[model samples]
Target chain A: MACFLVPAAEAVITTVASKVMQSKESAPETVHISLDGSTVTEAVKTPFSKKLKWLNNLLWGGSALLAFEHVWHGEVVPWFPFLSAASNPSDAAEMLHEMSTAGVTMAVLVTVVWCGMLAVSNVIENRAVKSAALLPSSK
Target chain B: MTLLTTVFAAIICTIIWYRNAPKSQMKIGILCWMYWGASLMWLVDAVFEYAEIHDEYFTPAPIDMLNDFYLGLSVVALGLIIWLVILLAKDPKGVVKSVLFKKKI
Candidate 1:
């Protein structure tokens, strides 16, 4: 029941943090000059990119926490028993099989969903660009 | 079982996210975070359960395992829903906004 609350809280925090931390400069650039006189410039990150990065960091942090917890529970043992938490060899095998199947399913499902969203986003962006191009320019 | 399932999901998501770290978008990262968080929560639950049940925690009944499996799937599904909601709200590409404004115009 309360599981939904975490993401809602995260969304609010991320949104506010993104706004608060938005850079004032139009395009903050980083310039690097090489020995051969070639310069490489890194483009400034948009506010949205910054938010994505923050969310990425949050995921990494959560992954670390979960890994630790798994280690604690012996479900992820390094040695002989493999899944130390399982009652027996057969149980461990079953659990392993179940986990693998679920993992693959979840990954494929998430990837498919992400691809759909990306396609939609691309379409929207293309339409916006086309519309802007069609507008008459003021001399 | 719920914890293990989510942990597996989180691990898979993390690997994919890491592979595309430079250009990562579409908010799969948020889904990863949600699963990991749920995994961590369930891990604590498992720990407390083990403390109470001792050795019996390992030899769970087949029916109990099946139920836990269902619960795990539900959590995963709920996590995806929450991520979708966030993605829609953020509308990073303004897709929703454009569609709404387009209808009005």
Candidate 2:
């Protein structure tokens, strides 16, 4: 019933990680002189934070939607013993079971999809780098 | 039914993204990813539920189907809202910034 919590938890972690990575990344250079005596700088590579943001967007969006579904079904509530399922011993047990099975499966599937996106992005970035290396600079 | 809604939304967003790939600054890609990911999640949910319920899964009550369709629409609306917030905050096209500055001037 509360399967969305799993992904929500993961989203929280990734959001924190994104913030930390952003802090650690170097500041942009203020000035650059190109090989052709131009002052323009090359396009900077996409930062790790931006990639993490893609995952965050996916996880958060999915989790929020799923949570809304649960709330609609009255499985979740605002007050204490937040999950309606938690109010009953048998339902709570079933809820945990569902979390372990369906919830975990959903989280894992989303993460796998995110990994695929990362792989595609890496390939594109590599191709761009290769092409840029082969091309002659022009003023 | 929910899966179908998300699938349609994803397809529409993908088409829009493709058409404006050159000069669009709307960041429609984020919306596309969100809908596609949710569609995949719901697909898995449906598969697991189908495994458990077998024939019953095919004949969900009419009321339940309506509820699901509404839920799917709400999800799409929520995604759009989030994307709008991001777009306004980022102001990729400087539209919001220009409006605010124009007000002051």
Model number with the top lDDT: 2
Per-candidate chain B TM: 0.85, 0.93
Model 2 misplaced regions, further than 4 Å: A27-41, A135-139, B59-62, B89-91, B94-105
Best by TM-score: 2
- TM-score (C-alpha, index-matched) for candidate 1: 0.46
**DockQ, cand. 1:** 0.08
Cα lDDT tens digits for candidate 2, A1-139: 9888887888899999999999998964332224233233465667878888988988887887778778878889999899999998999999999888888888889889889989998887666555555555522
lDDT of 1 by residue, A4-116 (tens): 22333444565566566664325544322222223332233234446344453443344334344455445666786544646576866756554454333333333344456
Candidate 2 has an fnat equal to: 0.49
lDDT of 2 at B58: 91
Per-candidate TM equals 0.46, 0.82
Candidate 1: residue pairs that collide: none
User: How many Å off is the CA of A123 in candidate 1?
Assistant: 39
Weakest ten-residue segment in model 1 chain A by summed lDDT: A31-40
